[model samples]
Target: MNALVWYVIMKWMPKGSSCVDFVTQRSLYEVRKRPSKSYSWVAFMLANICAELPWNTLMSVFIFFGWYYPIGLYHNAEPTGAVTERGALLFLLIWSFVMFTSTFTHMIIASVDVAENGGNIATLQFSLTILFCGVLVSPSKLPGFWIFMYRVSPFTYLVDAMLSVSLANALAFCSSVEVSVFDPPSGQTCGQYLSACTSIAGGSLSDVNATSQCEFCAIMDTNAFLSQVNSYYDHRWRNFGLMWAYVAFNVCAALFPYWFGRVPKSAKKN
Candidate 1:
């Protein structure tokens, strides 16, 4: 994708020209080259999407069957049985987001490279991208300024969408039993009233009394777990739409540098 952007910029723009001059010339040239430019742009976008689709699909399948299904990660209190569909959709959305964002970023970086006379900043960009994308820290934990970056980062949406699809309806079951007290003053015992004990939501230990001895039932429902981690599931599909919108924005943004920052071969001699 980066190479493609570089090629497009080099081929279309005049050399040894300032970004402002390149924009002016490109606009004039567009009148005659509009059709070709349009075709190339569409072709590039389609190629990017196509190239990534199959691999992403295969990985999604592997994760669903290998990790989610076998481990019962999608099991819920209601057992809706739509785990496969939801999980597949989630993965597809994530890939779509990744592909578009990558292309957009590459185009921007390519523009920068051209503007800077080909000084490499790929490493810097990669590190910044990762840092801002909520990979190193959860968005909820970030400070105010960084939180803005977290919200804008596509990874945030991806994580939310995945969590929603995978664990939205999941119910955490008690995997073991240990003798414990529910209420000491009431003389209630967990072992004596096993059926009365209910599965607790994740991060809800505050509701339990301090004297309660049921320390073993700390399991959480899927939704509750997500809440505890400050990840939401209510807008999973909405986020998918947002991701597509971001892709469109990237496509549009790529045009600016292509037109304004590109240098033409003729300008190199001057």
Candidate 2:
């Protein structure tokens, strides 16, 4: 659901299209006017980066409020009593996500003359990121040759950090349908029969003394489930940091294309 939201919003991010138009028309006009001859291309690029910050930050706040509490993800934070910490982390992550999206869109569009061309390229890349970000498919299950996509996709870190902080340490109570029922050995109680397995595998048994009915939940905790998907609570913060790294990469990447492709030949010679 989050990925879908990201895709929809980012696909039409206005910064890229607006920047394309500004560079082609307004900025060029500025460069042509005699009085604006001293205009700085660097300032134009920096302005774009800074100007999007407040809007994206506000957008992220609204998204966090709408998406976080209504889904009852707050309850997941209760197990460890880190509600405030977890909530703040999630908000920051969402903010970073918005910032990254804007910058990434600019990065893709900066070198293109037409907005539609840039949109097509952005769509293709975003599709690949969503596909390999470990949401649709587990990282462990990815083909060996394509595994690099999972590593390179910024969505991988965002999803990992979000899911790890949101779901880690929460306990799972298996419903009747979710539980596996079996009989203990004739000579032993259910607790005794399954103690070794539970100790190693980590699950709670409903009845210890029951001779015939042994109920088991294979997923003992949220952390255990996360492990199956190759995400860990210990790495959530690291992933958060990596996401900002990608944002930085996007900003730098956008600047490079604009400098090379959009800057005047006279400016380049200088």
Candidate 3:
């Protein structure tokens, strides 16, 4: 669903249609380009990586503006009330589902196949990833097992959680997001913009009275976000259950196949 939507938009993109779009198109020339079960992975990774660049950037931009992307979309309009941003909630849910589905499917099947087939695992992974770069590429894959991702949400979640772990790992490098004194605002602070937090949305907040920097503010916001996400575990057992399930499944997914398939075979050969 997400792949189809993304590719459709890309088709109309002023730049050009992406390989994902081309691959998904109902045509022989395009399908011939796929040539393997791994074709789906090629499409998946491309869409996944591309999806992040925009979504993450947008979320960060929203924060840079005054309207903190609400962790939850609850709203209050009349006489102290609360309502959810239905659209935002829907978007997040769908996006999460789509991105997770593609990435998890590709990484698992391709990694397994490469290791089993005596292929350069690194090259196999890289090539599949690059195929996501709108390039024609593929990974080694078993027929039925590899395509199993075509419609498996549970397996998708495991793959999705592992991918999320990988992403959080990469982003973990930036222990903090600092807006230093020298870091100029991405906009001007003249007249209407003066003392206001200028953002892409034309929203701004007056600088904290006599505040030296907004980096601290940024940090607080981030801490708040982490706290909020962590708080979800406390707010509902279902959330806690989901996180544990995701984590457990990811561990088992990565470990079971590799540990059982790799070590035992080598040990037996010994």
**Which candidate leads in lDDT?**
2
> For candidate 2, lDDT tens digit of each residue in 1-270?
446445544553444455466456534644574246655767766776788789888888888898789878889999789999999998888888888877877788767777777777877887788889888888789999999999999888888888887788888678889999999989899899988998888888888898987887888788888887777888878988998999999989988988898666654563
**Considering lDDT, which of the candidate structures 1 and 2 is the better prediction for this target?**
2
**Predicted model with the maximum TM-score:** 2
lDDT of each: 0.52, 0.79, 0.32
TM-score-better candidate, 1 vs 2: 2
- For model 3, what is the alpha-carbon lDDT of residue 25? 41
Which digits, one per residue and each the tens of the lDDT, describe model 3 over residues 23-120?
Answer: 23423322553355445533543443456446644543443232212422222111123123323333343334333333333334322433233223
TM-scores of the candidates in the order shown: 0.59, 0.88, 0.24
Q: Is candidate 1 or candidate 3 better by lDDT?
A: 1
Model 3 — TM-score against the truth? 0.24
Q: Is candidate 2 or candidate 3 better by lDDT?
A: 2
Runs in model 2 with CA error above 4 Å? Answer: 1-35, 266-270
